[model samples]
Each structure stands twice: as structure tokens, then as C-alpha cells.
Target: MLSLDYSKLLILAVVIAIVLFWPPKNKSFHRRGIDPGFLNLKVWPARIWFLLRGRNIVEQAYLQEKDAPYLLQSLNEDSLVLPPKYLPELRMLPGGKLSASEALVTSVLGQHSGVDVVLKDRQHYDIARVQLMRSLPTLVPILSAKVDSILSETLAACSTADFTHVKIKEIVSALVLRTTLLTFVGPELCENTELQWLVEEFTNIVRDMAIFLLFIPKFLRPVLWPVLPPTARMKRLHERVRRILFPKTEKNVKSSRDFPTVIDHFVATSEIVDEKEIVAKFLVLMAGALHTTKMSTSHAIIDLCASPECVDELRNEALAENLNDLPWHLDQVSCLKKLDSFLKESQRFNPPNYLSFDRIATSTFTLQDGTAIPKGTFISMAAGPMAMDPGYYEDAQTFSATRFCKTDESAVESGAEKSQWAHEFVSTESGNIHWGHGRFTCPGRWYASAVMKVVIAQILRKYEVKFPEGQRERLPNVYLDLIVEPNPKQVVRFRARE
Candidate 1:
């Protein structure tokens, strides 16, 4: 294993060397006027250090956005960071002209796994955009039930008033994956510990490996990937995933059982249902779906804990609705306006990234501001900072748990018209691109919103969550280039409410 890892490292180093030496195409745009953040790295050591410090470099760009877009040099690519005013233009560009998936694929070595191409394909996204969105109302019942059961099991493990300290991310990750699988894959894997383990392990590998693999060139990924440790483990998990899911899919096809899950929808929609395809797609879907909800829930929990008053508001709202007796319906979850506002407020402060709507220019494209981007230039909008800008939001830097709540006080304070988007987690007005921008915003956001609400509501109803003594403030998030993840070490005290 040591020998194999060293060989993989050697190959990776060689690929990096080759890529670095190669003359990059499309380095300049004729109409470009914006200043580059860090240019002309005359020394190789500075370039290497810059790569290590890429996230800070990009944050600096966000801090220094003047009147135009700014360029930031990443490990292997140069990205142009635009303000939110350019989002409408980005949304208008066709995929052929500026492809978000392609930019992501290139940045993360997605082409090697073939996951990026699958995601980019319109047919695959249609399943998410059309079927998943359409079925969310019906599926929320199952999702809510799953959330309730998972919370019961998790809380039962910590049934004490002495405050069982737990990492919110770990708990959220486990719960979100189980609930999502229950809705997407089926009960078979959701209940099976081995299958759940497989999903968790595979996703963890993808998340860790994708970042490291991004530094390696695409041409060499296939060559070096198999030699890496995670690659072998991922392949083993893939086969096991196939073994478990394929049989069920075939059985469903043979028996013609009508199930309310994504698998059933895929099987019904496809002319020739392929088990491998279905399994692969399901894994990919979980990778995207699970972490997003987990992070969102974790951040929201942190915010609620910081301001215990929000938790009181949510718990009261849930109690008024008789949450425990009522079935967790879409409308019921939607009615948790304070909870909705809390989630949205948390997202505004802690988004996936400072950037959103990432795209690679396919051809020379000019913005409304008359700046031209050359073909092959990577681009994105400053979504996170823009959302937190005081110009767009009053007291933007402060975390207001009930900022979006439709209470008379909040409405009067924030202005009824301005805080309208804060009522729904899916609402994306006032430069809030947590769901991205335009026609290609997250297709499953409605479903995602409902699932998160149910999980959070359950916690609020039964558990009193707070940070350890003197740790009321949230731990700062770890920023890695374009990614912002919740602090893994942050702990929360959970106890059954009296």
C-alpha cells in the first residue's frame, strides 16, 4: 500500500509539472479592464505558496471588489470574480457559451470520474428539475417520518438532561444521509447499517479526494487514480452499492411495484432501465444532496444555539401547530415561518462559498458593463459577500434569527417588501444565491427546504440544544478556496427539554 501511494504521488507530481510548463491558452481578453488580484508570479515558489493560500487570495478579491470584476489565480486555473450585478447576465448566457458544470468539472477533476458529465447532461438534471420537484409535496410525508424516526433514535441515544455534548455536523451528516436515502434510494438501504455505512464512506471519499485530485491534471487522473488508496476503497464501495441497489431495482421492475422514490421514477422514465446507471446516479445524487442539507442544518443549529430565543420561537411555533400529532406535511413545515427565517438567516451568514454560479467562458463574452471575458476563462459571482452587504441588508453583518419571520415587529423593522424573500429558504431575491441564480438554480431546493425544516422542527420539539458554557458563539467556518464548510470541531449540548 505504501509503495502504491508513493507511485500515485510520483505520477501526480509529474502531471503537475507538465501542466505548469505548458503555455496556457486564452490568457487575455481584448476588452478586459479589471485588475488581476495576483499576476506574474516570477518565482515558482510564490506560485506554489499562492496555490496553498488560494482561499485567502479569493477572500481578498471579495474584500476589494471595486466597480468591476477582479481576477484571482487558483491552483491550476484563473477565475474572474464578478459582483452580483452581473448575475442576470450570467443567467442569460446559454450553457454552450458559459457552462457552470464544465467549470466545476475542470476544477474538481469530475471528468475523470464521469460524474461531472452525467450531471451536465440535460437528461439527468431533468429527473431532478422535473420529477423530483414535482413529487416533493407527496414525498415530504415520507421525508418527515424519516426525520422523526432518525431524531428519535439519535436523541434516545442521548436521553439525558445533563447535556450530552455532540458534534452537530456528525449528527446532521448521519441523519441527513439516512433521511435522504429513505426518500431517494428506498427503505432497503436506509435501514441497512452496512449500506448506510457504504453511502457515508463513499461520500466522504469523494469529498476528500475531489479536492486533492483537482491539483492533478485531467489527462493523468485515470492513470494515477487507481493507485490511490481512496480510489480502491471507492471502487469496492461502488460494487457493493451496485450489488445492493441492482437487485432491488430489478425486483421492482419485475414486480411492477409502485414506490414513491427517485429509483422508481428513474426506472419508469427510462426506456431501458439500467441498474448500474440507476445506482451510479443515486450515489452522485446523495453526494450533492446529503452534504448540502447537513451543512445547512448544522449552521442553522449553530445560529439557533447562539440565540436561544430563536429555538424558543421555533419550539413554540411547532407546539402551536401540534407538530408531534400532525403528520409532517409540506404545508406544515412551510408554516414554520420563524424556522424558515432562521435557516435563511443562517445561510446568508454561512453560504457554501463566497462565490456562486461558477461558469467557464466557452466563447468571448461581454458583460453588460462592457468587460470582455475570453473563451476558457473561469468566472463566478460574489454571492456570499453580496448577501451580507449592508447596502443590500440593514445590519447585514449581524445574525438576526427572526430576520425573515413574518411577525409584526420583524416586518415593521425590516420592511415588509424587503424581507419577503426571507420567508422561504428557496426564495432567492436581494442577491441571495444560496440556491444559485437564474434557470439553473438548484432543482431540488424545495425538497431540500422541506427535509431540513422537518429535521430542525423535530429537534426543537424534543431537544434543548446549546453550545457548551461560554461557547455560545459559533466557531468560525473553514474556508478552502471556493468552499466554506462548517467547523467540524464545533460541539453542541443536546438534552431533552423539560
Candidate 2:
């Protein structure tokens, strides 16, 4: 009976896949056209090819069609790949027309997975944009202190006269989550080990659910969600998170603290004060903040370990600035030009994702060049390829640690201020879209940058890090469809600096 039921479901799924994967009979490509490769095949085969070689496919298309818009069929949807030239116009389009949030919802199957906070309410993001940015001046010092304390404890616990192997991702993830939670909840609540475990588990659960649901047809999600193991785990985790966070959120809503947190701001500003709503918002914010920052920091450390020659250079810069002797000021952090450039270079080589400026057209629109974008068409820029394109950066294939800072050298010689010479890691320029571009560019970038700088600088000042013996290069990055991640098991040897 069970086998028979499974067979029926499998047959039903294939039928749905066949219908969904059927190519449009009258595919239109306004002025600029669909990639020739995609035009010749049924959309399913093209999507399969994409899953196999999406990065290379994107790079090839970008190199081949540098000037014009082209269409590429991806799993789940077709995206109109636009050149950077269209960025200015696209940025100006109102959210109702070109909706990044809606694009995210489609990308993640958010409606089925309960990750639609952006579409349901913009208040959390607005609070992050305004209050979070407003609080950074005060927040930086607090974060710096927290980072220093955490690193000191980490190093002490792992101390050995000789080098000791430590998983870099584990260290970085713990540090990123703790600091993120400190900023979100408060110092006291951030220290709850159970709460921390739940948040991490919850992030993993949601990510797995999203991936599982991605292959399921949209119409079938409602039917299948109840029996999905991840869904059950998600429900239990959500309840656990609410139980842990509700009392604190309820308390915060009534009275503000001296040092305002992201939760406090969300409660104080948002009209919706329901405990479940606040907890959901917190989970969304924590997941975003924890994942990207953790990956970037881990990659930066691995990059540093691989480029041993640059280690002393960065260490000297950190020591020269007395970064460890005092709480970090934003301006002081900015002045670490060499470190900043190295970080930017690392990220250029290992971005969080291959695409950026992702949006879905809510209504049909025409480009200045007469290319038409039909309503419901998904769109993205080939950000990963563009970052390495020779047209954008000279010797783009090589990792030049000082590529961004070399201009600063001339500025310094001309007596320009350090601020003038400093290149920010959070730049969303066309040439560097590691952070998504436009009005919807990452809101917490400034905070992420500050935290990363502090954590890396502390490591350089207090410890020596290198890849395990015989590992001469950084571990190759793991790629999942469009997303990129530093290898979670990558290990580095660490010893306290004498």
C-alpha cells in the first residue's frame, strides 16, 4: 500500500514538472534577445544545464554579450540578465514596479517557508536602516569591546605554545552570531547558550526547508509541507525561539534601555508589537546578519592564511594603529587601508553569491534602448563575473591585495586625508557588487564591516594563523547553485603571538 501511494505521488510530480518545464511557444525578446543556447532547447534541459554549470554559463554569457540584455533560463524561473548600464534606471524604479522583495520571495519560496517578512512588513528593514545606522556611532565601540573580549577568551581556551588546529568557520560563526545577537537583543540575553543554539539550528532548518521546497512545484507546497520533516522542525524551533525571546521582547516594548538594541528599536518604532511578530522579525534579521558576515570573515581569514606574505603587512598595520590598545573608532577602523583593501580583494574572489540586483518586474517596462521587460520576468546582474572581468579591474585574474589601496598611496603622497584614501568594503559599485546594488543595497553593511575589521584586526594583533601543514592554498570555495560559501571544515593553525 505504501509503495503504491509513493508511486502515485511520483507520477503526479512528474506530470507537474512536465507542465511547468514546458517552454513558452512564443518567446519574445524585445530588441536585445534571448541567449542562443536557451532559445534552442526545452526550458527544462536549459535549467538542468544551469544547475550543472551556472557560474560558467553566466560568465560566458556576460563575456559574449557585454553590451546588451540577454535571457537565461534558471531552475524555477527565467531571469533577464541586464548589463550594468541599466543599473541607474533600475535603481530609480519604485519598489511596486521592480520589486526586490518579491524577487526574494520567489527565489526562496518564502511564502511556503514562512520567510516573507520583507513582503509582509517593511518596518523591520526601515528600523534597521534608520535606527541601526543612527546607533552605529555608539554601537561601534560596544561591538569592538565585545569582539576583543570574545577573541581573547577564544584564544585563551585554545592556547598552546605550538600551533593548534582550529576550524576557522566554527570560530568565525560563533563570533559573528554572538556579536550580532548582542546588537540585536542585548548583552545579557545574547549570552544565553540555549537561545544561541536555537537560533543557529533555526537558520539551518529554514535553509534546508527552502532548498527542499525549491524543487517542489509551487502548487504542491501546501499539500506537501505538513509532512515535511523540516517543516515540523521549523515549527518546533519557531516555538522555542518565541518562548526564549518573548519575555525579553515584551519587557523591551514597555521600557527602553540606555543602549538601544535592534529589538528595542523594532518594538519602539513598529506599530505591530505582537510577540510572535517580533520573534519572527528577529529570526529573519539574525539569519541574514549571521550567515553573510560569518562567511566573509571566514573567507578573509583563509585568504590571509594562504597569502602568508601579506600577513605581516596586515599585522604591522594593525599594530601601528594600536587597534588592540583601545576600543575601535570608526575612523580608526577606516584608516587600516591595507587591511581594508585585502578584505575587499578576498571578497572579490569569494563573493556570497554570483548574482545581484535581483528583482522581478511587477509590470511590463521598456528599456531606453527599446528592450522590453514583461511583467513577472525575474532579473539579475552577473555580479560574480563582472567582479573578475578584465574590462572592470586590471589583471582581474590575479589577487592583488593592494589593488584598491594603490590609489590611496597617491592620495596620501598628495597629503589627502586617510578618509579620502580608504576604500570601503561595503561598496555596491557596478564593478563591485558583492553587496547588492541600489536603494535595496544591504542595510547592515556598515555594521558588518566594522565587526569584521575588528575581529580580523584582533586576530592579526594577538595570534598567528596559517593553513595546516602541506595545505599551501586556501580551500576551494563551495558553490551551491548561485550561492558561494567558504568550506565549513577548513582548518587553520593558530598560535598566540609572543
Candidate 3:
């Protein structure tokens, strides 16, 4: 008997989330070695080891030892990882000459053979981001409509009430999927289930393949990359994408098409590259925006459900600002200051991976404290440590939604220097806590911020979420083989509020 009850599923999910998050018993899993070869082979084992030890890789090794503001270490460029303090020096060759961003991407995808953006430096990332971000302020209505449709469709198949819980993941997944499809394939194709399913599957295949592919020998990688099943699916997704792309092949592509999506801009301005190359960009665009954005937002929703104080403030802000009935304007997105505060607090407490940015020296460079890092080196900030470090943020590991708020309040009270806390929150120009300081940071940051705001607002306005009775806040343990990612999955419930 296939007894399917979503509430039960949510209960099981909460259990799973707890298990995934429960600190492991090993501490060395979080420690670093200088070789990518060592990481690729033993990432899982290391994660398990570190989980048992209760120390992240960095915490177990360098971070614990360094009492000075910063210190010199013998770790070299190709080390699979580097300690936190050396990150800035590792960002560029001395004098801001050569960047280390290239090394990070190359390490992830295994080959720069295809991503032209990698070869072009920050220019390509910036242009693509500008095009995408410039289009967001206009997408408010389109995104709202898509969200409603996803909710209606998702709830249509569900049954939840006061005594029941709903596996919020499916509902949220539906929301993310529909919104992404609208942007990627345009509304006409987006509403098509067949196409949307294909796109979602294609995304899943690429990510899973990436995880598995990293284990293959470097020599075998180049030879095997093309033979992977995900590569074949990518070709098909691309072929379909090209069919959708050709109409705007610059003949009459408008700067702002009715939808103004990545596909609209790509075929409109740039010379046509290889079909695979174009597909790769589109795939990356979808994956980049949806995966991280959805995961973070979903977790936030769960956190809010767990903390009614946070949710009540968010709901009041959204309703007070006329968010419910109005189209999602940029102002509406911005008015949720408390919501933003809550989001930042969540990130502070549970960063994607106990680390954020990646850097590798192109040449030898010295730290602010006079430590020399050899050229072509790798390093990442201790995300868990940095965000948790009281030196930078008070009560570093605690969730203080009003922590930055206090900064703003103090500025207002002084009536001298106005608080730019929110501005700093939104501004990538100043770059904080390793969101890839400066230009090489994720180009899609603005788009990401917008989506997060919309989703949070939507949830706050419509649902009352809460953790199961007696459950506690869960902070994930991230294991970075390449980059930081949230631990596997979490389960939580959402019920429509009257």
C-alpha cells in the first residue's frame, strides 16, 4: 500500500535534516591538505572524520594554531585548501596583478576548455551580470504571476490543515522550478510540463555528474567528460535551447524583450558561439540562480517557521508595505528590512559551507602581516570561523537579526554618520565575508537578492511555518571537496495561515 501523506513526509524530512546536521564525531575531516588529488579521493571520508571530531578542516589545523592576527605557513599554491588569513594575499599576484578566481572555476569544472567567460576574466562575468541584473526591476509582475501559478498547482494536489503538516520542500521546489522556467524558457515554454521536467532533470544530471566526475583521475577526466550521460543530456537540453534561441538570433532581438531573459540577451548581442557553448551558459545560468537561491531561501523559510518572532515581524513588514496585492517592485523587495536582517542572520549562523570565497595566487605574495604565499596557491576564508569570529561580528555565531540593525540604530541616534548597513548588505562593491570580494564575486548577486526577497515575502504573507514540537534549530556541517554547499537536505512544514 502506497500511503502517501505529505505531513508524514515532512516529519520524516525533519528527521533527515536533523541527522544530516548532527555534528559528526571526527574532527580531522575539516582539516586541509595541499593537494586536490587528496581531496577528490577522500572528501567524504574526511567529512565523516571531521564530523566525529567536531572541528571543521580549518578549525582543526591552522585556525586553532594562529594566535597572531595572521601568520606565514608553508602551504603552497596547489594545496587543496589554505588557511583563512592568507586569502587576501592569495587573491592576486602582489600589486593586484593576476587574479586567483580563474583557479577556483577551473578546479570546479575540471576544464576551461568550454567556458569562454573563464578565459575573458571578470569582463564576461560583469557584462552577463549587468545584462541579467538590469532586467530584474521589470520582472516583478512576471515573477509574481509565476509564483502564484506554482502555488496553486502545488496546493491543488495537497491536503493540509490545523492538525497537519506539509512537506514544504515540494511546494518550495515547485515555486522555484516555475519561477526559473519562466525566466529561462519564457512563459510560453515554461508552462509546458514536458519541457520544465526536462530542464529540471538536465540540471540534476549536471550537478550529480559534477560531484561524481571530480573523483575520476585527471588524465581519465578529459577523456571521460564527453562520454558522461549528463553530457548527452546537456546536448539535448542545448538543442532544445537553441531552437528557442534562434528566433532572436539578433535579427530583431530587443534590448528588453517582452521577458528580457538571459536567452534574449545572449542571442541578441553576442556573435553566435558553438551551440554547446551557448547551452552551457544557459544551463549555468539556471543552475547558478536556482540552486543556491532556492536552498538558502528554503532554509530561511524553515528558520522563520521555527521562530515566530522572526516570522511575525516579516509578515507585518510585508503587509504594512502593501506587498500582498501589489506587483513585486524593487521597493517592495527592499522594504522587508527585518526579513533581510533575518536572512543575513541565518547566513551568519549557517553559512553555505563553513567558507565562501576561493583564491589561488598567480605568483608569490605577502600577507598584511608579512607572510609570503607562493604563486599559484589556493585559499578560502574560514567561513564558519570568519562569520563566527567575534572580532568581525559580535556574538559571531549567534543569530542577531538586529545586529546590523543596532549599527543602523546607533547611526540614526548619533544623527551624524548615517547608517549604511543596508547599503553594505546590498552592495557587492565593498565585498564582505567572502562573497568573492570585488568583481569576481558571483555576477548574479542582484538577481539572487531579488529572488530571495520575493520568495521570503511570498511565504511571510501566505503561510505560517513552524518546526515540529520539541525540535531545535539546526545548523548544517558543510564539507567542501571543492566549494561550500549546504548539507544534503532538511524537512519542515508549512500551513496556510488565515
**Tens-digit lDDT string for candidate 3 (1-498):** 235687789889987766555543222223343222322333444434444442344555545653322211111123334454454544443425445445545545524223334444343465457777777877766787667666656656333565244565666677887787677657666667766666666556656666666566667877888888767766676677666655445654343347666666665655655555556666655665676776677667767855676667778888987644666787677766777767766666655555456555567655677655566555545556665655555455556665555554331222222345453334321114535554456676677767777777876777666766666764463544424444445455556766
Candidate 1 local distance difference test against the native: 0.71
Residue range 113-141, candidate 2, lDDT tens digits: 66787677788678767888888778778
Better of 1 and 2 by lDDT: 2
Rate residue 385 of model 1 by lDDT.
Answer: 70
TM-score of each: 0.83, 0.86, 0.75
User: Candidate 2 at residue 133, lDDT?
Assistant: 80
Runs in model 3 deviating more than 4 A are 1-55, 66-101, 112-117, 120-124, 157-164, 202-204, 207-216, 224-233, 244-257, 363-370, 408-419, 423-434, 469-472, 475-489
Error (Å) of candidate 1 at residue 261 is 1.3
Model number with the top lDDT: 2
lDDT tens per residue, model 1, 1-498: 999999999998987666566444344431122222223322344345554765565556566653457665554455677766666667767777887667766666665553564653565567778898887777777777777777777767676648888888778977888888777767665787888888777667766677567555556777887777767776778889888776544354323223467877777787877777777777777777877888888888888888886677788998876545565777777788878888888998889876777788889877776777888878877777777776666677788877666445433224223445557888776457778767658877887898888888878887888899888588989876557788889999888776
* Model 1, runs deviating above 4 Å: 1-52, 157-161, 207-231, 248-259, 406-422
| Range of the 10 consecutive residues with the lowest summed lDDT in candidate 2 | 30-39
Question: Which regions of candidate 2 are displaced past 4 Å?
Answer: 1-26, 29-47, 157-160, 248-258, 408-422
